[model samples]
Target: MSGLAKRLAGQTAIYGVSSIVGRVLNFLLTPLYTGRFAPAAFGIITGLFAYMSFLNVVFTYGMETTYLRFANRPGTNRRDLYNRVLTLLLLSSFGLTALLIALAPTLMRLLGIPPGSERYAVWLTLILGLDAVAAIPFARLRLENKAVKFASIRMANIVLNVGLNLFFLVLCPDVLAGKYLSGLAPLLRPLYNPSIGVGYVFLSNLAASAFTLLLLGRELLDFRPRLQVTYLGPLWRYAYPIMLMGLAGMVNETLDRVLLARWLPEGFYPGRSSLAAVGIYGACYKLAILMSLVIQAFKYAAEPFFFAQSEDKNSPRTFALVLKWFTISCTILFVAVSVNIDLIAPRFLTSPEYLEGLPVVPVLLLANLFLGVYYNLSVWFKLTDKTYFGTYISFGGAALTIALNFALIPVLGYMGSAIATLVCYVTMAVVCWLLGERHFPVPYPMSRLLLWLLAAVAVVAGSWALPPLGSWIAHMVHLLITLAFVAAVWLVERPERAFRRTQAKAA
Candidate 1:
């Protein structure tokens, strides 16, 4: 194999394993959380995280991508570049953390969350800040090909977060209130607040972020930072469009939660059902995020690799091939989830009310499939430094997302948000493709891509047409059928046959 291809495969495995394992492990928490916490409580969790997503982009100042671009530039002083970036990140993170803490109460009130809940906001602030500082170092790990360590740190954080959650939610509250504490001090028993559910979730995240900081201590201390204006000038220019894209991208992905809370009038659902419905939507969305998981893992390597190896003749062809395989994998996942959601949703969430959001899962899943394709298509602008064009597309998507959610939420509630998301992602993907071809055309296999998509939609229709054999048994049969359909596509696509022929010729 070629060196680039080999590196891509190895790094992809490391990052993919970390993502898949982390997501699967974290997926276990969905059942526990949805079972225990009220919908409003989950909404609180959802809203806070959505808020953090935007803040993270702000806190990092797009330095991660900036680091990748500058660090790979010819004749660049790698050590100086790394140091300056880290130094700037440290200063910026501290400022952002403090700023958030100071503004926490007002911000909470503005978001329609209660005021005394400043503590949750504070936890989120610290976590985001810590994450921002760790961003480039993490990217550095990817750039330096330290995938093992990269994956290791990510797994460790997930483990710590999950452990802390189980302790606070399951073990601590009961143990502290039980015979042991009761015997020691009856008054102390009253102090145990089992009602402190979502707050504890934030606390767990904070503890995990702190632990991650300590674990990355070696990487943190080793890089000695110094700013150079000449390097940063062009670096900032490259990153500005990325920052806009990141900000707009976050808005498209996340602004719905914020808008839903603000736009939807009270009494949308029965007895705070709006919040609960949002939580349900959030959980179901995770099921669809399988596409996102793969895209994320590929992106970590693909972005830097694309930029660094820009001039190579094989780069565009390789991207085209990756895009095709990405669609195929996502198409398989789409069919599996659309067909077997009845089987999976029960394991992932507890309440029957939560299951109402199941229909949204397939819609959101297909949209994300297109979103991943758009990400692959997005390399054109980045490689050519025409990132502003990408930013414009994301902005258009974000505006559509917000406007649709606003107009429809009062009428449709949580489902409106899902529809808006689906529309926005599809729009972004289509627009990116049209504009991208004009700038830097890659040979995407349109016929194969459409075939996979059409086959997935057909499987969805087939699964739906089959009689409901009582939910459980019906779902099982549908899952098997879905797998059969995917296998059929794999046979027709003939990927393995093509691979063997290429190898034989090379030999």
Candidate 2:
């Protein structure tokens, strides 16, 4: 492995401590929530978080990336720039929280929540506000290469979050039932509400976010920024475009859940309401979120890694290899999950009611693989200051996403949403790859890469076609098929190793 690749691996490993671990801890909650909550109840929980996903993009307003861009420029005042940016984000987050709290009734009504359930919106509002405030502090850790600190806080947040979820979803219910604390039941009566089932999920998240903000005391309390109008202008100029891209990209990422309740026709599925369908889909979506975690872990490392590598002449080749390896890994993940889902889901992933939408999981996994490739393809635009091209691509994907969701949700329900996700990502990935090659050509091992992808896909498709056997027998077959795909990739890469050796000798 090259030095750069080693560094990338190290950084990715450190960052994964948070991204991967945090996600796993949270992923564990999926089964717990799915087990206890009905499809509609869990769907409400999923829908609320989907809104937060988009809101995080809005609340941060691209300052996360903008800070990175300006902070690294020569002769920049690091402290001043940091203080200035943090101040703006602080005000924005606080103001947004106030506005949402004041208008909770109106906004919750617009979101189609019941009149009595408007407090969920208020809780989510506070959650997003605290997260937005903490955003730059987290980003600063990444910028400073404080990977350990970053990972620590992230682990803390995940542990706190998982612990709270357990207390609310598991212990509280047990306590109310007099399972352990008969005497304390009266004291906990006000804290626990059986009807407020999904509210516990939001409440846990709000407490977790607050704990994180408190941990970053210095960043939160810093108020000595110059508030320079001059600095603000350039940052906005660079950031707002990224913000546009973020908004559009988020639509591609999450709009299905947001719109499903409204766009999914009345009486589409036999007994399930639109929100119920959302819950099923969202629960199944969590099954594929393991792939998403890998993609996210790579992103937290790769975004900065790519920027730093822009000056290296051999970077294009390195990036191409990175894409090849990433595809191979994602393929392995998809096959592993798709094949063993039966064994996995029953054990700890989701409940029986949420299992109905399990078919969408494989499709969503493949879609996320394409999305990962698109992020790798973004090197050209980010390096060349043509990031606005990203905006255009995201806009195109967003349009496609919205149009397809509108057209298909009524007919196919959540399955339509899954298909739309697949199509949108495939389009975006292909578009970005083609355009990036024209503007910033890389010697990508496209042919061999696709061969590995196809092999993995083929093995997975064959697994699907296999006869149903006993549980252990089925798992054995799945394991063999996945291993076969891995071996095929290794065998194909073998000759390339020899060829590289030959080239090295010639040099």
* Best model number under TM-score: 2
Of the candidates shown, which would achieve the greatest lDDT relative to the real structure? 2
With a 3 Å backbone cut-off (N, CA, C), the pairs that clash in candidate 2 are none
Cα lDDT tens digits for candidate 1, 155-267? 89988999888877766665675734435445444544565657888888899988998889988998886766776688788787888889999988888888887787889
Show model 1 residue runs off by greater than 4 Å: 1-7, 177-195, 500-507
Q: So what's the TM-score on candidate 2?
A: 0.95
C-alpha lDDT (0 to 100) for residue 87 of candidate 2: 86
Cα lDDT tens digits for candidate 2, 1-507: 456766887888899889999999899888788788888887788787888788888899999888887777779887788889988998888898898889989877888876688889889999888888888888877888888888888889889989988987888889889789778788878877888777878888888889998888876566464577777888898888889999998898889998888898888877988888888888888888889998988888887788778888989877876887777778888888988788788766445667778788888998999899899888898888787899999999999999999998878888899999999999998899999889999877778767766776677778788888998998888888777776866676664683585368548
lDDT of each: 0.81, 0.84
Runs of candidate 2 with Cα error greater than 4 angstroms are 181-187, 218-223, 494-507
The lDDT of model 2 is 0.84
TM-score of each: 0.93, 0.95
